[model samples]
Target: MGAISVKSKHLLGLKGMDRQDIADILDRAAYWERQPKVSDALRGKFVANTFFENSTRTRFSFEMAEKRLGAEVLNFSAAESSVQKGESIYDTMRTLESIGIDAAVIRLKPTGVLEELAGKLNVALVNAGDGNNEHPTQALLDLYTMRKHFGEIKGLTVSIIGDIKHSRVARSNLWGLTAMGANVAFCAPDTMQAPELEHYAPFVTMDEALQADIVMMLRVQLERHDKGLIRSAEDYREQYGLTAERAARMKPHAIIMHPAPVNRGVEIDDELVECGRSKIFTQMEHGVPIRMAVIERVLTS
Candidate 1:
């Protein structure tokens, strides 16, 4: 809807967004896909990219999106910054603000940190990913990817597998997909499922999950191992990993997806990474323009 053009100054999460608002973003992203890839959409603007957590795709896709839009980018490295010396997140945001950064795309390990900072900041804020909270743009690009393939998101069945408890992608996708009329489900073990997601049914077995238009496998998130969420990679693969046998059982038209930094053998078989139905790489490619739409929308709003 016009809410994005009217009121959305920050993309903190997808929980509070309307269906039409979600549709608007996908529409805008589709529009951007056909236009020139490079533009001065954010010319003379300075955007800061701050990542407190390690990342490869999300961080770089954001950088590429900002550069493609012709915005001056300030890459904030937590390793070399005052944060390593105990500088608080608020202070770091203030530092960027004082220096006239027009917007910030941030990835942090703490949930709700972006919303807390959004209240105090003047520049536009884009939540690249937050701790098991939400990754709105990732969700947007996902919807775009599906729409590009199926001609629409409505009525399509989407099954998200793996560690839903710690996946911001799952949270984001649920909100975005369901809002656009898709039937969303989760396929994960009891420990891997999010108790908060009661509206959608989670299948405990892969057979039930494969009865969908899209099958998305999530990374195991080894960092959560210290918390005892998983035992070992072998143990995980044995229980819930997408093996070649399982992939073979999926519906003939069912496509595969993974939010990357994939542990190939642990989550999905290595060969399926580039399989005909796998949109894992295409999802990554969609990130740029979807983010371009987001950056333009937020900054101009």
Candidate 2:
């Protein structure tokens, strides 16, 4: 795929996006963070939150971002729409476009559909999440969090630990972090590993994973896996969870992160979720500004 133009209106994913484009969005996010809570930046525009999958954070975060920018918002749920009656995602999106939405923040269960929709749609398309493909805004907020803490992304080490085989967060983080010069690593059980991503980063042990500058835990997506991969929550936690003992061994400056709705004790210990070194909630706070920047950029640029 070609590099995304600076003026590219759609934020499909960060996989092949330009390094400078990522930096620009982060920089703009910092600016938005400093401004007042609301603005008329996107005034007179119509933005739709069209989700084909269930989401809490990403969906609400995009809605908050749109409202902050003063864009009129339309929230769409697959269950409440004609999608339940067998309408295609493409047709649903087209219907929104026909209704004069200037942009669409979409989350779908199928991969590659957003890319096809981006090519066919007249309005800007922002990827909220698409299967295990990518979640650009989540990655952007993550990068923003890291940059806010460490002051730069280059030379930092980020270890993403958990179900790599079914994580769009891990994939987006891998692409964006690598583009910004961070060394990325994956730590997961054999069955949870993504073979396709092995060439991009090394698969390390729990000890090696904890040694990185950033320790990101991914939610164990039990829904995507068969019954045998993980026998029980306790078993999975003992093997891969960021337990208190393991967190104690991490470097003094390393921070913890997760793209939530976290699995509490399954992927990370409950206490560590809000520990001093954890940036989980901070990541959520940054989501609004990062998404505001993305929405403003797509609509105004």
Model number with the top TM-score: 2
lDDT tens per residue, model 2, 98-131 = 9899999999989999999999999999999999
What is the alpha-carbon lDDT of model 1 when measured against the actual structure?
Answer: 0.87
Name the lDDT value of residue 251 in candidate 1: 92
How many clashes show up per model?
A: 1, 0
Candidate 1 weakest ten by summed lDDT: 1-10
Encode model 1's per-residue lDDT on 1-301: one tens digit a residue: 2323636789898886888788878887777778787888789999999988878678889998889889999899898899999999899999999989999999999987899999999989999899989998988988999999999999999999998888899999998888788998888877887877966655556788878899998988777668788888888888788898999999998899888879989999899999899999999989998998888888889
Q: What is the C-alpha local distance difference test score of each model?
A: 0.87, 0.92
**Number of the top lDDT candidate:** 2
Q: Score every model by TM-score.
A: 0.95, 0.97
